[model samples]
Every structure is written in structure tokens, then in C-alpha cells.
Target: MSAESPGRRLGLRGRVMLTFALGAALVLLLLAVSVFTISRGYLLDQRERSAQRLASADADFVKRRLAAPNADPRAALMALDPAADTILLLLRHGEWISADGNPPPAPPTPSLLAEVAAGATTLEPVTVGELPYLVVGVPLGDGDAFFEFTPIIELRSTIQVLGTVLAACALAATVGAALLGLWASRRVLHPLRSLAGTAASIAGGNLDSRLPEDNDRDLNTIVTSFNSMVDSLQRRIERERQFVGDVTHELRTPLTTLVTSVEVMHRHAAELPDRPRRALELVGSELDHLRRMLDDLLTLARTDAGLHHDDEEPLRLVDLLDHVLAGQAATPVDADTDGPVLGRKLALVRAFTNLVDNAERHGRGLARVGLHAHGDHVLVEIDDHGPGVEPAERERIFERFATGRTARGSSAGTGLGLALVAETIAAHGGTVHCTDAPGGGARFVVALPLDNTPEDTIE
Candidate 1:
């Protein structure tokens, strides 16, 4: 058999969960990006507006002080309030002056100072060294400008926290989506699993197996269709089995008469010519083969129709096997083990006979036949000195009409013997299988549940 591809081997549930997780992650990522972008813009815009207001107010205070009669430019710049995290720069006559004690690492750029000198106000974000700040410049009347630098470390921290929270939420949402996918997949596939089980039971010869009624519309439709199909298949199989049973039943009387006539011819063979005697022998042999085939077909039909004539009785398995072996020409090395089984005598006898016949035809001959009790079961092992069965073909060979590559020695089997044996044993709640025997041959083992009850008797 070809191996399945790895990519295709993922089950439906896993695939659904993966898809849900991917979709949820994608949505959450988009939402996170939108929220971060909008919040960051709002925070920065509010900070910039507040800085512009403070700078404008400080510029008006310095302008009023500078307009005084004995105003000193440096002292007037120093009169304005400067917060600890804020720096105030005054540009007068193309020179920058600081209102606070500490000055900026670098003075304002020429392009920015020129913009402020041309009667335009500038509010922009700037970074100095490792710290982020907002720069707001306002042009004061008469060739001077006031600038404020406000540190924005708190805004940066708030945005970082928001990003971390959004990421965590996205992760949690992805996990939730996976869990939801698992639950949904199980709910969806439950009916399918039931259908598969019902189909398997039907395949295993339980024709009555069926799906339960469901309230879901789609599932109900499927269940109805599946049950209807099984009903039709069961009816068709029953019809075929019935036809075989009826045909074989009708042919029995004629076949028996033919056998008797051939036997009479064999008795009077001395009166016939050599060629005519050979022809009679061939006819008799063919008729015998045909008779056995018909009997097997009748048994199978009855088995299929659940018509078993089970006269349950306590049977000594070793004695029964010895009797069967004695009936055959080649006597196997038999072992007498103690075990009693509750079963029908005729059916068990026929089943063992079929096994012996199969071994003789397919294998060289029976090498050993033994019976033993193990726990609550009795095992009968029939060993044959022939080419052993392949592992793959062992079970298939028991199926009706299934032939394997084995030594037949000149005898072609009807292929129904082992199948009949299997059916008979199964009816008695037993199992039979072929395994490798000692000294390189095939061994057929039949395991029947032992019945040690004191009330055991023939019915």
C-alpha cells in the first residue's frame, strides 16, 4: 500500500483548529494595530497641544518683561517659569539662550530658528540624546522667539504598555479560537464516526446494524439514506442465499439417484469394456465432487439464514478427533487431552472433517493432531507437513472461494471446505486460525470454550 502524504495526514479537527487560529490571529493583529495607531495619535496630539499652550503663555510673559523700560533680555528670559522636565530656549539676534540652568545638548537647527523668525509658529517632535521631547516655538514681536522642550517619556511608556496588552489579548484570542475549533469539530464529526462504526459492523456480517435516529436535518437525511441502502443490500443477499439453498435442496434427490446408479455400474464393471469402465469411474468421481459442493452450499445458506440445528451436548474433544482421524486413511500422531465442549456433535464432526480434508489436499498430509485445554478453552491443533501459508493470505484463505498458492498435490479443492469449517466453529463461539507449525509447516488451531458444567448431556 502507498503511504499517506504527511501534509494530508492531519485530521479534520486539527486542520479546523489551525484555520480558526490563523483567522483569529489575523483579525486580532489588525484590531491591535488600529487601536495602537489611533491611541498613539490621540496621545501625541494632546501632548503637543498642551505644550503649545504652555509655550505661548511663557512667550507672552517674556515679551511683556522685555517691553519694560529697564528690561534686560537675559533677565526677562529668566523670569518665565520652567518646569523640571521642560527646557525654555529664547532666540534673539540669531543667538539661542536658555531660560533654565541646564542647556540642551545641541542648539535648535537653523532651519527651525529661521521658520520661527519669519512670523510662523512651529510645533514638532524631536529627540535629544536618548530622551524624546516635544518642541514648540512661538515668534515674539521684534525679532525674538520662545521655544519649549517637554520630555515625553511617560507617553512612550503608556504606549509600550498598550502594545504589550494588545499582544497578550491576541495570544489569548488565538488560544480560545483553537479550543472552540476543537469543540465544533467534535460536534460535527460525531455522526460521521457513528456511521463509520455501523458500516464496519455491517461489513463484519451484521446485516442488522443501523444508525440511530438524529434530530439534525442533514444527519437525519444521511442516516435515512444509509439505512435504506443497508436494507436493500441485506434483502438482495438473503434472496441469493435462499436461491442457492432451494436449488441445492431440489438437486439432492436427483444427485443421490445418479450416485446410486453409478455405484451399480461400478459393481457390474466386469461386463463393460475398458473405456466404458474408465468413463463410469470419472462420472462417479465428478458426481461425488459435485455432491460435496452442493452440501457445502446448503450448509452455508442455512448458516446465513440463522437456521442452526444445534443439539448441544458435552463432547470429549480428544475422542471426537480420534474418531475423525481414524476415518481418514492417513492417521496423524494424535494426543489424548481432556476437555469437554458444549456443541452439536454432527456439526463438529463435519467441521473437523473439512479441516482434515483441506489439510490433505492443500498440505502434503496431516503430520499431527492434538487436543489440549488452556484455561476455559479447548484447543485442537492440526499440523500439516507442507508449505506454510503466508501471513497475509492466512485469514483470506478462510473466506469463501478464496484460494491461495499452496501445494494441492493433484487434488483441486472446491474452496468451500475451510469456509464451512470457520462458519461451524464460529456458530459454537469458537475461533480457528492458521499459523506456522514446528518443522516448517502450517498448523490449524481451533479454540472452543470449554463447558465443565456437571449437567452436561446430549440434547
Candidate 2:
């Protein structure tokens, strides 16, 4: 047998409901058969007994008529009446005779005839033409015999009505089971739905998200375990962020002093020789790089620790990118579409500047920049005319502390620029990724959700 997915097969609730329906149908069918059998047997028994009694009485009267002077079998049978829908027949001197001079409705079976000929009374069910009848045969002395047939159409009708009622009941029970299954399934799967929702919230950066308490024992076990796991993860992340924040705070003062001291040294650049001047310049560049790296780490730490301010506002994507590029070289931009996006102005600026800076430092300078809207999102593409990002490195490029060669052969980035870009964009409910740009170069694409309406609706 071929394997199939769980979704393709009948679901749990459907199976449960089907089980109940099938079980009820099987049991009801058995009961209906049994009841019909018993009732039919009982009714047929009473009918046969009553028929025998009436036949006996009719036979007694015919016998009396035979005893009379000039008596005739045909006349006696025709004259003697029994019940409605009953046919009488008489056998005298090896000849069969029916009342009304018509064909007999039912003739005794050979077995019944043999039993009756042996001087014993017999009763058997038989079909007369298109209808059903009971044949009662009684033996008379001197090779004489009598038979009676009675129609049982009414009894068959009653049984039919009974069968219909039973079938209807089975159908009703099945429908009720389906309704019950629907309700029970929702109740049974409610906890699972809650778990999924909480997990989604956490994935969206809500570390405090937790499953609520449940009353069911089995469900409660899963809830407790999931909540405990989330709590542990949250605590570990908290400790790590706290350590990063503390370290960055400690380094800030010394780093500022170093930069200030370097600026003072650059003022007297003419007195120094070429070698010394170059050496001083290298120190200042390294210091600047270190300072940028530390700042990126601190921002990440604060964001993770939930200490970042939410001073967000609505801003246009075109304006945001234009301001970032205006500080440096000219770049092509398409500003035909896209609405404002909700974000912090400083954070958005910082992330966009990092992209431009990374391009200038590593990817052989920015080749082209494009901006447009797609559906409910604003897409920003920054292209560098250098060897594009490797397919294998595309996803990893966004990780913190991830270092790799720029489009150029040299690895000159702070290793945290793209990471910070990804983090900041994600904070604004956006995404950033690397791809191969059109015409063979690297591309950094950022997509932020469009905020078309006001910051908050007011009536």
C-alpha cells in the first residue's frame, strides 16, 4: 500500500464520528432484523393458529353436510363460509375441488400433503399468485382432506412500516454523532491552537508570551512543559543581553577618549613624516571601526533586553532612502510608489546608512539603488557592481559577527553592519536579504510593511 499524509486521510474528529455512526448503524441493523424476525414469527404464529381453527370449523360443517342425504362435496364447500380473503378446498375420492368452482389459490406442498395424508394436520406458508398466504391442511377419515389459505398482506405492510422506522432512527443517530464530533473536536484541539498562537507571538519577538493554564490533565502537561521551555530561553537570552550591555557601557568611555585623542593628533599631520602619518591614520581608522562594532552590539543587546524606546512614527520610504544617500555619492532611485512605513526615524536612518557604508567599503561602491512598492510592502534594492554574494553565504550574511569578503576580494566590513540592518528592519516588521542583482552584481533587498493609515485611528 502506498503511504499517504495524515491530512489526506480521515481526520480524528471525522473518524470518531464515523465510528459512532457505524457502530449505531450496525447495532440498529441487528436489532431491527431480530425484532422483525421475532415479530413476524409471532404474528405469523397467531395467524396460522387462527386459520387452523377456522379451517377446522369449516371442515366440521362440510363433514356434517356429507353425512346428509344427497350431499355433494362441491356444494358443501361452496355453501360453507370461513373468513374474508380465505379460500377453501376439499379432496374427496382422489379429486380436488375448490370453492366457487375456480382454481385453488394455493396447493399444499408435497411434504405437507404427505404429512396430511398420514392422518396428521399440517400448516405451511405458501405464495398464491402474487400475494403471500398460509396453507392449513387437515386430514379427514376415508381418504378425505380439506385445505384453507389466508392472505397476509396486512402483516407484511406492518413489518415494512417497522423496518422504515428503524432505518430512520439509525439515520438520525448518525447525524447527531456528526454534530457532536464537530463540537468535541473544537474542544479537544483548542489547547493545540493556543499553543500555536503563543509560539507565533514568541517568534515575532514577544519573549514574555506563554501558554495559559488549562484544566485538562494531558493538555496541562504540554502547556506546563512549553511555558517552562519558553521561560528558560527568555532567561538565558536576558543574561546574555545584560552581559553585552554592561560590557559595551564600560568600553564607551575609553573609546571616546581614543577618538578624541586621534582627532587632536590629525591636526598636526604636516609635522609628521609620511610613515608616521600613515601609521596614525591607520590607528584612527581601526579605532573608528571598533567604535562602530561596539555600538552595533550595544543596540542589539538593548533591543533584546526590551530596553529600546518605541518612539516610532510614520515615514515615507523614498524620503528615508534619499536622505541616507544625499550624504555621499549620487545613486539612481525609483520613487513611483510605496506608502509611508511605521518605524523609528533614527533606527531607520542608521540601518540604511550601514548598507551604503558597507557597499562603499566592500562591494566596490554602490552600483545602483532602486525603490518601489509591491502590494502592502515597500521594497528597497541596493546594488553593487561587484561579484555578487555567494548563494551559500546569502542567509548567513545576516548573522551577528559574520565576516566575509565583500564583492571585492578584501574583507573590510565591521561584520555587524548587515546584522544591524536585519535587526532594525525586523524591529519595524520588515525583512532584509542578499541576492544576485540584475547584470551580475550583489544586491541587498529590504522589504518593509507599508503603513498607509495614520499612526493610530481616532474617531
Best-fitting candidate, scored by lDDT? 1
How does candidate 2 fare on TM-score? Answer: 0.86
TM for candidate 1 is 0.79
Per-model TM against the reference? 0.79, 0.86
* Model 2, runs deviating above 4 Å: 5-9, 29-33, 79-83, 214-225, 262-282, 405-410, 454-459
- Alpha carbon lDDT of each predicted model: 0.84, 0.82
The list of candidate 1 runs beyond 4 A from truth reads: 1-7, 72-84, 92-96, 261-280, 311-352, 368-382, 387-409, 422-459
Top candidate by TM-score: 2
lDDT value for model 1: 0.84
Candidate 1 all-Cα RMSD: 4.9
lDDT of 1 by residue, 281-384 (tens): 89988999889889899888887787777667888887788778886656753655576888888889989988887777778887778787778898999888
Clashes of each: 0, 0
1-459 in candidate 2: lDDT tens per residue?
Answer: 989976458777777666766777788778878887888789878888888888788888888888899888889998876668778888888888988887665678899989989998888888878888888888877888988887788888987887788778878876777777777787877777888899999999999999989778878888899999999999998888888899999999999999999999999988999999999999998998899889888887876765655578788778778889996556857677747888888888889989888778777778887888888898999888777788878887788777755323555566788888998899889999998988778899999998867745411
* Window of ten residues with lowest summed lDDT in model 1: 403-412
